[model samples]
Target: MDYRDVDIVNHQRGWDGYFKLDVYELRHKQFNGRQSPVIRREVLERGHAVAVLPYDPVRDEVVLIEQFRPATLSVHKNTPDMPAWLIEIVAGIVEPGETLPDVARRETMEESGCSIIGDLELITPRYYASPGCTSETVQIFYGRVDSKNAGGLHGLAEEGEDIRVFTKSSDDCFAMLRDGIFCNAPIIMAMQWLMLHRDRLRREAASTAI
Candidate 1:
């Protein structure tokens, strides 16, 4: 498909802190096979992340978490009832020496207090949370879990995290999706994937039950 387009002329760090900002000056090949004007763009360099959707096949339920997001509050200030807390699947940024599955398991424990039962099923090629302005790719997975004791408040105190966990049936999760309870990309994608693969997952789990 000859997808080659962007040509980076220069890239410089603009800010470095909890997150990084990179300024880029570049040109791209136009549809007419000519180079377009060089433009300056600033990109947020949030590191890669991993998210795990913990599902209990026997109970047809999933575990999720709620946490405060200052960005959401900043953007939706006029709505007094729009709390900063967001409902999402377990997720964490990739550390320097961590694998995707490692982040998934660690995040699952920190955010939901649920232990993943077996190997995680990779969703597929990772996705960018916002490609136009950020270089953050997220690896998604579906992990088997026992959601019997999955509800609670869990998070790392050192990280200033106060997370609340919830377990909901697959049907209820879908209803929340329809009701606009989940606004994050990872959660939406995971739920949609589950919607399509839930039955297959259940059948496979049943076949493997001993």
Candidate 2:
């Protein structure tokens, strides 16, 4: 249960952007009585992010975001001309001195125009979206909101995020899952959790309101 096998001899940053580059000197002791060289690798210093899945009980719906994801097509697409449009929960990189819930609420407002936050639920925390190269940890949350008049594209002009928000019925969202309309991993997981807990959530909402 110990990760003491790798020790840093020297380290430094190598990149300048949203993420940081980290270099580490490692020493590995072989089980067969051998010691390897002082190997060095440029590691990625992961950044923290947050996402939210907003649900509306009265409307029986959830809000999702659709945007053009350039990276997906660059890495996974068979055709270069194809656009990698993604349907995902609202998310944003955590700003300095900001709490996770605060980031979630801010992102919700920016992406969906849902100014008020209701009951919040932690879905899960996860490692880098792609651990092999990027260093990013995402904290995900779910909550109920009033999606009665939610729609249209909204995002910060400075960040170049042209996001379109969609409010769909629970039944319709689940049907999209069955039909493979949702291909993003995090959104898929969130939807699956909703599927598993929908009944209990409805019961709780009913009892609490009464």
Candidate 3:
């Protein structure tokens, strides 16, 4: 409920660099209102991020990106055949002076070459990617786009990003979802949200056309 509920005995910075790691020693109130033994935990302090699913309601299509993630290599070492390149929606870390929508639009262009056509529809509230070990929160959005020319390789070379973009019909995307082709959390959540609201979004896009 409050800081009083968790008694902070000690804390120290475990690592300081591009990202931070913090180690905390604390005791919290138990189910029976008793104080539990002090426990030490290390949390990764990744900053917040924003993700946008670019959709073309008129064409019934969505733009996605494929990129390699070194983090997945460790998890797939035994499988060897499992691809480390993941399919995901456009996303970026929130810069110091940028708003969530700004990040969404900027990332959409950088990752997919798709310009957002209208205001982003907030799909989900802030959610932690890995609450157990990280303090990173992500906000998700659904934004209209013109996907006719969305497919291509795009990314800033200086940033070491080699992203391949794909513009797929909603049905195709849904099939990928059913087959577990998407491994990213934001992409899965965005696709599920689109599946539920696709019809309504199409109707709105139709009205705006006239």
For all candidates in order, the CA lDDT equals 0.90, 0.81, 0.93
Model 3 lDDT vs. the true structure? 0.93
TM-score of each: 0.91, 0.85, 0.95
Please give, for residues 94-125, the per-residue lDDT of candidate 1 as tens digits: 99999888898998888888889889998756
Q: Report clashes for each candidate as comma-separated counts.
A: 0, 1, 0
Q: Judge candidate 3 at residue 17 and give its lDDT.
A: 92
- Model 2 alpha-carbon drift over 4 Å, by segment: 1-3, 28-40, 76-83, 126-128
lDDT of 2: 0.81
lDDT of each residue in 85-204, candidate 3, tens digit only: 988999999999999999999999999998998789999999999999999999999989998887879999998999999889999999999998887899999999999999999999
lDDT of 2 by residue, 2-106 (tens): 467656678777786766888778777767756668987776776778888888766688988899987786656565544488888888888799988888888
Model 2, residue 16: displacement in angstroms? 0.5
RMSD each, Å: 2.0, 2.7, 1.3
- Cα lDDT for residue 144, model 2? 74
Q: Which stretches of candidate 1 lie over 4 Å from their true place?
A: 1-5, 78-83
